[model samples]
Target: MSKYVIGDIHGGFKALLQVLKKVAIENEDQLIFLGDYVDGWSESPQVIDFLIDLNKKYNCIFLRGNHDALLCDYLKNGNYTEEWFIHGGKSTLDAYKTLDSVTITQHIQFLENLKDYHLDNFNRLFIHAGFTNIKGIEFEYFKPLFYWDRTLWELALAFDNNLKVSDNNYPNRLKLYNEIYIGHTPVTRINKTIPVNKACIWNLDTGAAFSGPLTIMNIDTKEFWQSDPLPQLYPNENGRN
Candidate 1:
């Protein structure tokens, strides 16, 4: 059985389905999603519904994202900020307009139950964003950092490639895992539309919320698949651009 990690979907249900079709996933395969399943596109609520159903039939691990957290808070308390609304939240709100209260509550439960981070048997770490404890994720005092921090990725990007884990100056956080898989910061920002490896950190968010395609990668083989850009999938919408 293979283990696949998906990047930020950003409410592109069509893009998510397209990539999954490319993967031709099997029942034995594990699907680990890096969250941001909602927001950006016009089908945010549908994306959540699909994920809820998908998990019942497949091995799926859904992690919490900053957007997901914000959405959850909005759903639970009906509170929203101008920043949240502009950052794809408005689209998500529009998508949920047709859903009944029962379905909305179910979606809220799904969002509330999402994991902050997942550590696998092989010492691979999967998180929506990054964590900051110098010791490790478990030692992280601020739980929100698991899905809100960017310093870890920033550190990886700036790290000297020559620095080994055994080196005295190596970042302690990078040494905590054999590999770190994250999706909050899209690689498209660096002009890359594919999964990027820097040090031991791998960024899988290929900017589905913007101009790039949705992506999925096999953790073991590093084999990946991508769908057409979100704009191409939803011809009329601007997504989060």
Candidate 2:
């Protein structure tokens, strides 16, 4: 069975559907969803519902994202900062208004249970963001880095193309895993709307929360599929753009 790594969804349910259909996923396939599942477009609640149902039908690994953590905090404590509200949280809160208490509770539970990262048998690491510890994830002092750090991505981006893995100067973090797949920071920031490879890290977030499409890639083949841009699919609503 094939294993596919999905990018950040960010409430683009229509875009999410489009990419999944384009991928033609099978029941036997394993789907690893890097987070930011909610907080962008108008369908944050719907996205969570669909993911919950989808998990029942397939093998799925869900990673926590910074936005997801913020949403979880608000859901549990009814506390939200202005930063969270302005950064797509308003749309997410609005989406949840129609849900009943039971549904809200279920959504909270789902969000709380999301994994910070997933390490595959092949030593490929899937995380929402990045870890800073030179030794690796297990030794990371700050757990939130799994869903919030940008340094790892920046380091990868700044890596010298001429450097070999065997070089002593190669970043220690890049050598921790065979491959590291992450979301959280959109590749669109670098002017591309496709998954990008830097060093041994694969950044799958193609800016689904903004103008770029949601993406899904086969971990083994590097083959990928994308939806139409979120702005096109959700023209009526300005998603986190």
Candidate 2 lDDT by residue in tens digits, 1-241: 9999999999999998998888878899999999999999999998999999999999999999999999999999998999889889999999888889999999999999999999999999999999999999999999999999999999999999898879989889988899999999999999999999998999999999999999999999999999999999998998896
lDDT of 1 by residue, 42-104 (tens): 999888989999999899999999999999999999988999899999999888888899999
Best by lDDT: 2
Candidate 1 positional error at 217, Å? 0.5
After superposition, the stretches of candidate 2 with alpha carbons farther than 4 Å from their true spots are none
TM-scores of all predicted structures: 0.98, 0.98
Per candidate, the number of residue pairs that clash is 0, 0
Q: List the residue pairs that clash in candidate 1.
A: none
